[model samples]
Target chain A: MDSTVTTATNESVWGGGNQPLGASYGKLMMWFFLVSDALTFSGFLASYGFSRFKFIETWPIAELVFTHVPFFHGDYPLYYVAFMTFILIMSSVTMVLAVDAGHKMQQTRVIWYLFLTIIGGAIFVGSQAWEWSTFIRGDYGALETKGGRILQFVKADTGERAALADFAKNIPSEREDLQRDKGLWFQSEGYLTSRSVDEVVEGFVANPNILIRTETINDDNHKTVLTREESLKRIKDAAHVVEGANLIHNEYGSRLFADFFFFITGFHGFHVFSGVMINIIIFFNVILGTYERRGHYEMVEKIGLYWHFVDLVWVFVFTFFYLV
Target chain B: MAHAHKLEIFRGLLKFKTNVQKIWAVLVFLTIVTTIEVALGIIKPQALTHSHFLGMKVLNWIFITLTLVKAYYIAWDFMHLRDEKNSLRRAIVWTPIFLVLYLIFILLFEADYIYNVFKFGFVKWNF
Candidate 1:
């Protein structure tokens, strides 16, 4: 015990000294903060798991839901998401490289690596925004039953997904557009769907090749497709036409699935946004030679920890949300 | 602070001379794992999907395992947790691990119970 205190106190405040964990206070605090952040994410994922389990038979299959790429029109399941995963992982690599260069006081190398990391983060955030827009504007429209169930369409001959536009016939109706100035000034109606429920039902009766695919999953793990008569019977129960996903309704499948998808991914995207902002600030600091003057690049290392933590959370998110 | 990097991965089976080389190696490893995950997810082999273990699909088990492997490499190597002292590593890693497992177990079990209620009982599925 070092009893070298010259004041009235004879013993060291810390048992041995400061940094018993062999880490700086700032680094240790950062680690603790990450731990707490990890738990917050875990709570979200666990709730997601709960909802999935509760609706295990009716939960939407991720491959069918997220098959669209930015420009492509074909079915490419998990492709863009995989691309996003690779981008995040690559950015993590660049961040660690920057930290390594910082260790050696290579200011230029650190700056360049940080620049790459920033670009990677920007690309990821942009991709996420595109994904959210696509999810909001769903591809194939579906019918929402009175019980809040989704009924999609499939071609009877090909067993492939069929869009509502492929079969619905335009039927003129007497329904008036409810605008504020037109009628019911204080009671404006919701956005009217292009095709009404009556038109969809009328189209279904005309198209013999279309079948209704209900939300129920059979023993084969495929959605339960109703026969011709059953499809005719089920169409009468539909109350609304769901075009895309939102907090209330999802054309894909269960409303909970879309809710969790938006909340978890949105929260993660926010994290990436903040991480990019932090990285940019650090990039400017490096350019200004702040660390060089300080004789260490610990600031870069601290931010690197945060960047890697984001990647780590994405790894789990990719697994549970997309893969599992 | 020029700390010496512990450059070996995969239980010391592979070693790198420089930190940069090790970073690339880990990247390749993560990429391969992710590729396998994506491929399996897309194909969804019938045999694996049909089989159930621990009341969950075997395919999901594989995905979760691979995800854990990726998480391990990212945390231990990229975050430099491996180089951190034991106390700090445990403080950051163990707490979440224990709590998350417990939370998942409880929530999943409760969810399964609710699912059964909706399935067998008179209570109907409203949404």
Candidate 2:
């Protein structure tokens, strides 16, 4: 009877069915999804490379632009980002250990490892939020001129950041209610009255203390920020001084590069968030002995694939975004 | 008895019981290497900056080399690629190798071309 059963199974195993890619159905689907996701990421990164190429001359240096931190300011270059990378890498390690525990049928071990992985992921996401906030709230603000150029200001003595109000000769005394409407149309909910271009220029001309200069009018080597005296000499230089990094133009740093950096890293952060959720579900299952009763922990292996993919993407991200 | 010998051989090769210890060792090594890389990157000595290798900066080469080493350990030990069949291993590894190389080559070359255009183009980017 056993021999007959073995023969029957052998015939079915050799039979030509429309099986996918010589892999199990689940693994095949996972591969297909990964391929599409990879293409999407590639498209974003390629567009970034193209934009970087287009603005090759005045692109922001990655190290200098992302160097600042809150409270502990002054040239803290790449340290925080490196720490974030380590957190993600360590999470990947925990994920692998979880999978190994699952393979050994050690349910408690799986739970502990998964728990650690989730914590690591949460920390990474938090770090990313801090990074984004630092970027949006720029250290130095600049004024946008009519010709789409950015004009930035600095202190005369210490060369620290000078506020936009410091450059204003006549600070607008009449507080215009942004919500007040001239016509029948109601004002926009989020509308705020920003200082106008003419107002900025008038303020600059009026205030003898505030100096206006373009970003490109640096000293010969372009390594150091221009001094107030040097800035006065190069005022006629046709460089746009812009305040902060934005989608349209980044005067505080490289505009195109910043756009790509946010988009790519933001997508990866979304992936980490999803991975954490999946790991949570798996963690609960491990605690309940669901896999123990089922005789194997293949679920852990599947999720491990996803966790590793996140780590792999981060490896590339660290290289391009930070190291390069 | 013969099957028991085969089992012992497998156990010896895998070192399954000590896998956890090995994982910790790899993690510690990776941390040390990363710290060293960051230190070197921050210091960025003048001599290293002046040197070039294979049309790239020496510092960049060091980064690439260290990254490859990290990748090797991650793939081989953590992912158990070392225990897998050579064909399966190559299939997984070679694809990324070729793709990444192609991407770096095209992007860097185009970047240099664009740099040239900016340096000599009639249209000034700053203007």
lDDT of 1 by residue, A92-150 (tens): 99999999999999999999999999999999999999999999999889999999999
- The candidate that wins on lDDT is 1
Indicate the TM-score of model 2. Answer: 0.79
Note the DockQ of each predicted structure. 0.62, 0.23
Cα displacement (angstroms), candidate 1, residue A282, comes to: 0.7
A41-79 per-residue lDDT for model 2 (tens digits): 766666666666655435555665688755685888879
- Evaluated at residue A175, the lDDT of candidate 1 is 65
lDDT of 2 by residue, B36-80 (tens): 777876777667666788855688788768877776766666655
Q: Record all residue pairs in model 1 with backbone atoms less than 3 Å apart, i.e. clashing.
A: none
TM-scores for all predictions: 0.95, 0.79
